[model samples]
Target chain A: MSMQDTASSGVALWRLVADGIERGIADGRFAAGDKLPGEMEIAETYRVNRHTVRRALAALAERGIVRAERGSGTYVEAQKLAYPLRSRTRFSEIVGAEGREPHGRMIEASEDVATRELARELGLKTGAPLVRIEAIRLADRTPICVSTTWLSAELFPGAGTVFAATRSMTKMLEHYGIRDYRRGATRITAGIVDATDAARLDLPLGRPILVVDATDLDLEGKPLVTKHSRFAAERVEFLVEP
Target chain B: MSMQDTASSGVALWRLVADGIERGIADGRFAAGDKLPGEMEIAETYRVNRHTVRRALAALAERGIVRAERGSGTYVEAQKLAYPLRSRTRFSEIVGAEGREPHGRMIEASEDVATRELARELGLKTGAPLVRIEAIRLADRTPICVSTTWLSAELFPGAGTVFAATRSMTKMLEHYGIRDYRRGATRITAGIVDATDAARLDLPLGRPILVVDATDLDLEGKPLVTKHSRFAAERVEFLVEP
Candidate 1:
């Protein structure tokens, strides 16, 4: 508290240091999972008291930027695979962009009646039988994403066999003659993981996950794929293109 | 552990109950965040022991399907989101599909030499200056996404003025007599939030954030926009056309 520089309006010296660290984060000078220098080192570098540096680092810990190990120094949290926010990239492709091979396991492929949400996406009557495919996408043998796709059964029969052969739902649709697909709109939200998904994805339930609800369309604007994907917050990402 | 029907093994009863609930989760019968029945009630309903019910619930938790809170029972985890794996679309349009008005806070807009990454994207020299615009994008009023775009300054002279107008960056380019852009490949990654970015976006540092890195080109195959975006996990998504 004795150390004083310029802006001494009682804003707290530690806070100023914390602000600088925050800027570093926003500007990408420091990346995720990176470790900061030791408290004594930071104090010397910033010309501040060691306690003040501790206070700044403490602030960071509260904000979840740094993880404090009692005897050891703090560490940045591990990051997940991100989705491109500004591009037209597929989930499988984004995973590869992150340098991880993308592999999807088809958990269940069956016909079921459309529920309220599926009906809206498919533009089908409620309770209409539809083909539902539940698949889990993995990276390095770790399950990171879970998806459920509902398709109009009337549009494609025996899609299961085709999908089983090549593992490309898109190609299977083409084999059944519904080839053209233009991108469509999506609905997005954040939700916590629940019991069953936690088991399948091997995640702790109550963990927050990204929810992307999307509908694909044909050249004629016909609905093609209506899928709901649950991604582990710490494991996956969505990118935006500009 | 001792409770079971004579004909069926104890483990079988648990599996059956687990399957029933798993089916509900897969079928969307028990939506994310929906509370599940109590062990007693589930046992009565599924015709199994309470121990069987507990085992089933435990299994679900392991799969990230449900979370049980003491005195509050179990609830479904949030639904998963699916981001695309391919390269396509623009950033503004991607968020637009999420049904939100997207806007940005212009941070830096200047014509400077492209760095190594930008040079590779624009097929220019390492020191070749590009029109770089940095902004923090907001969804509605909440501060969420951050993006930086680099456009070849050689192609556009007064590109700095693009930030002055509220017009979209790409549109601003079009107004300057440049039109049409074809997207190229993009890189996506998921990592922990750096202390700096976590502060700017008002996110807790060390939390998982999504990132998308990509370059764009025009009809003549001249590079247009090289964008890198960092997104908070809860506020972003990507769509797959296929």
Candidate 2:
């Protein structure tokens, strides 16, 4: 349903109707835990056949988004993953704790001028030189997520070599006189998968995805690295507190 | 690009290609600041025309996912948000602190038998009665996300009416002499929207979505509820800690 293209296929009308219904939920109209209208009602509302409506409803049920009872009718699903937003936890730590083998492989690394946005996060100026590291972390051999980090390039000129040879970025930073990086701030959002991600994660083209944008600071309130991570939803989870 | 059902219109294939790239970053494959493969390389890799690849890459640049230097080629986007993790924060509390209005509207309230999955979260028998509530919380009238919650029916028989009236199941629990509920655990993941969620959130069918699964606990470790929230990619974000 996230398709920006038109519905031109010879797909069933119910499937199209179902697409409309799913979009409503994603867009926050129907909302979570909202009960859908009855069959006759939905059929009328969507201007589709009752059978088509039923098919849509059936699709909802299969995803565990809703449930139906013989006489009680149907209802929205009740479920959530309460990912704590209090403090940032490293993906390696959380994924490791979950008994999954979490590994990060350096995909690319370099030093470059910080753009205006990167400069803000690092408290530097636009075009300020910064060290950048990009890696793909995985559970076992299967690719799961990706991350790229930016730091004051002057402060970590040799960061790429360390990342390639080390087990932890934090550990390497410590060796480079960064005993600790104070917490700065974080941002989380959702987005769909682009071409590169779909291929790496083996997901279907244009699959929806979860994106987390995070930044860390040093003791002097200097930005260490701005990290953006994207995850294939079906494969990974954020273990959090509330 | 979130459309797994295939497109029927004359939409550009380049758009879909761009979506795929965005998907890669989300999965952490194309980490921030990482340089993409050469344009011609991407074209060959994706089996698409070079022009199509250029358009897709251009889109990423427009979204701030990457930078295109005429001579050097395109680069990955640096991190944007300063995300604070390693702590705990409440949704309503945090959203308010950000100067964003937090509102909750109950969408459904009912009592029913716990399914196998529900019983596992609430530590109850599979057939035990449970009260479920679905609500959509808006930040500034924008339907940012949706959540569904469940509680033991035996402990909260007034759930249906109180939730409907108050529009906040969390507050209603407070009225029942339940002072504070601790979140025992949370899980986060990402995926493309299913049919129903696509409808609820008003997204295109099969669009990308963020899914969160969580469980709450009362004092003395008494299981309280299991909740699931799904958000359209780009609608809202989850916080870990600050």
Candidate 3:
């Protein structure tokens, strides 16, 4: 039957093709990392035109089930990185434990007055002096997240210089006599990446990003730092630990 | 200046309009539940065409920052529901604690053989008899999530009937002499809503949804149920408790 004939069955043609391929992947007919059939081949097999096949592939790509390479054909996406959310969550440790190289680069650092929202989060007065740092974190050279962190400048003077020397937030805090810290709270919301963040993370505009608004507390339960981090949703999945 | 003149400043007209309105919302000029300016008024204010303003509004709606009403104009979305992720996560309790009435309806229920993935998740043999239940949960008359849950039929006979009567997995399991359960592990991912889910949840197609894969274990840490829940990303934000 033609594609239009199948549409009469109450399912869209493109959706049928997409569901067929998804079932194949689930059944191990198309294994992980396996390149999918070309557009012309999929069209022939489904008795649909190339445009229908392309639409199916686009849907799959948007779901993060498959990825289309620039030169190569479409391929099934590998397992996403499982990021554990716990009291002592650490980015470098999480990526390292996953057997991937973790890297963080400071994009910009400056002294600034805390905004009303930031001040409330950090339990400080608005316009309080703070050290603001913008950084990008990568795993295996793939950009995963971009974070903007704010710290009380009075507590950790010259934190930017220390952080620049050692690309580790823990190490920088340690230099300031803070030995340990834990996650205070984390609020996660989903949003589309804006143009500025899209360019910084090398992601396309309108792609989904997980926004994490978090605070870290010192050993005495005092808020040490407040951060806003945006993670690429397709590259990582947060595993909530209780 | 004309829209073309503003577009030459390295940003698209639609994005500029979106950013302008975003700033207005952030600065409290447009509070939550406030109706946005009409398309013609926005076009006149920004000196852009109605099409560009519509595209900007569409982008905002996609991000869930603003919602469009069919007959009424657009309005900023209210604060998202904060869903806490913990070992003893209870959906009804969560909504009730937030001062909202919780409701659930069974969409489909049947006895089926466990697939490979479901078998692995529940530590059951492949093709084992399973009771599958599909449900949609709502809070304050708004649909929040659609879930598919599977339990071993051998362990919980007549679970489908019990769940249908109770409209709750917890209550249904209690009827089978299983009193308590805890969340074992949760895996979260983001995806666009498909046609079936969009229709069920009253969401627009291509909007983002948070897919949560979780397993609930009994007192002895034996897997009792495996569930996949798709939440409306725009209506809720998950708070990971540590």
Candidate 4:
């Protein structure tokens, strides 16, 4: 049914306007990063008052479908990064394939004893030495995710040093003479970014973040590393490949 | 590093308290859906004032990590539903596997002309006749998602009627003599729920929603149906399998 028909059928008028604009974006009438028309224009087109149009725009902004600038008009938000979850998933490769420059910075690297949860995930003793590397990954200079990776320090001595040099787990694994690995398992959940992640990812407080707890395995299917990565929900989405 | 170490490393006092509580939850000291300690108790434990404790709880509430009840204390939110993405994905099966009763209710159904995007997704000509069905799916009587599914009207005559009777797209296809289908492709993104969806899903306005745009194919690998499903991000997270 048409937006007007829905509005006439008891749906809120402002909501109908919001849905109409959303449909426009979906149909490519308003492309990503394209500025929306002014409030007066939208009001006239939707046959609603400026107040209703303002409410509609507010709703869109709250949804993150559109972003409003102080001096500029509202613009459709950038398209989300389409991250593919595959057997051989690689962050650099994924971001590169999307035609975005990928960069990583090590925030902290240390050797520590595994906690009970970390030990269970990595199949190690609770007191086993673990090399933990905390890092933030960026795509085109936009912070996309913050991750903390843990590995058995016994397996890869000096892992923190190697990772600090390479800033990539894959490259550091190669430095350790392990050539190939695959995704073992991933558990996904949605949560608000904690204070630490919010600052690291440059995300607004309380914004949704996609939490992925994953393990990687060596060619022999032995667990190599367990990591928790939190992606800014507005900037990236995981595409699960069958 | 320890919580105290981070707390002393220049983070805000209130944030440190929040992180400590979050760590407690992660370590199973505070289980999901459990009421947190009283504000006074937490304040004393964290060596902070009651105002700081209240701020920390407010931050947690905004993050969807914990919920505050009127006249009662704040409680940890329930664990998310892990919905796996695989070739032969089935919603009912997923929810049932999670030990929850799956239910679907038809909200709207009609014959409609395909828009360009819909036509491309369904492998039909532009303006082709299609049957559209909008539904709300619940797990354990709690609304989890709202979906809109479309199929070729010529290929599946009476699809709307069959789906209404069965409350299942799989069953409706089965009624048309197609027993098996597989997920062809799925694109997932995160967004704030629009007004209609907020109302239908019984979610608060501006809550995060995980949008899954997917196409299903028959055994012969021909596209049979296309759908857009919006899951409540707080309630469910999609696990994409390789």
What is the DockQ for all candidates, taken in turn? 0.10, 0.28, 0.38, 0.26
Chain A vs. true chain A, TM-score per model, equals 0.67, 0.64, 0.78, 0.76
Q: Which residue segments of model 2 deviate by more than 4 Å?
A: A1-102, A179-184, A218-222, B1-103, B219-221
* Model 1: CA > 4 A from native: A1-112, A129-133, A151-199, A202-225, A231-242, B1-104, B109-113, B138-144, B152-162, B165-210, B231-242
Write the candidate numbers in order of decreasing TM-score. Answer: 3, 4, 2, 1
Candidates' interface RMSDs, in order? Answer: 14.4, 5.8, 7.5, 9.3
Q: Model 1's CAPRI class?
A: incorrect
Give TM-scores for every candidate, taking all chains together and pairing residue i with residue i.
Answer: 0.51, 0.65, 0.81, 0.79
Fraction of true contacts retained by every candidate, in order, equals 0.13, 0.60, 0.45, 0.36
After superposition, the stretches of candidate 4 with alpha carbons farther than 4 Å from their true spots are A1-29, A33-35, A41-77, B1-29, B32-35, B41-77
Model 4 scores a C-alpha lDDT of 0.81
Identify the leading candidate in terms of DockQ.
3
Task: Give the per-residue lDDT of model 2 (tens digit) for A1-242.
Answer: 22234442223455556656665565456667777778888888766678778877786676566787877677775332223344445657666756677787788888788777778877888998887887787776667777778877677778888988885777778878887775556666667565566667665444455677778877776667788777765455566654
Report the poorest 10 consecutive residues by lDDT, candidate 4 chain A: A1-10
Q: What is the lDDT ranking, best to worst?
A: 3, 4, 2, 1
* Candidate 1 CA-lDDT value: 0.67
Which residue pairs clash in candidate 4? none
> Which residue pairs overlap in candidate 3's backbone?
none
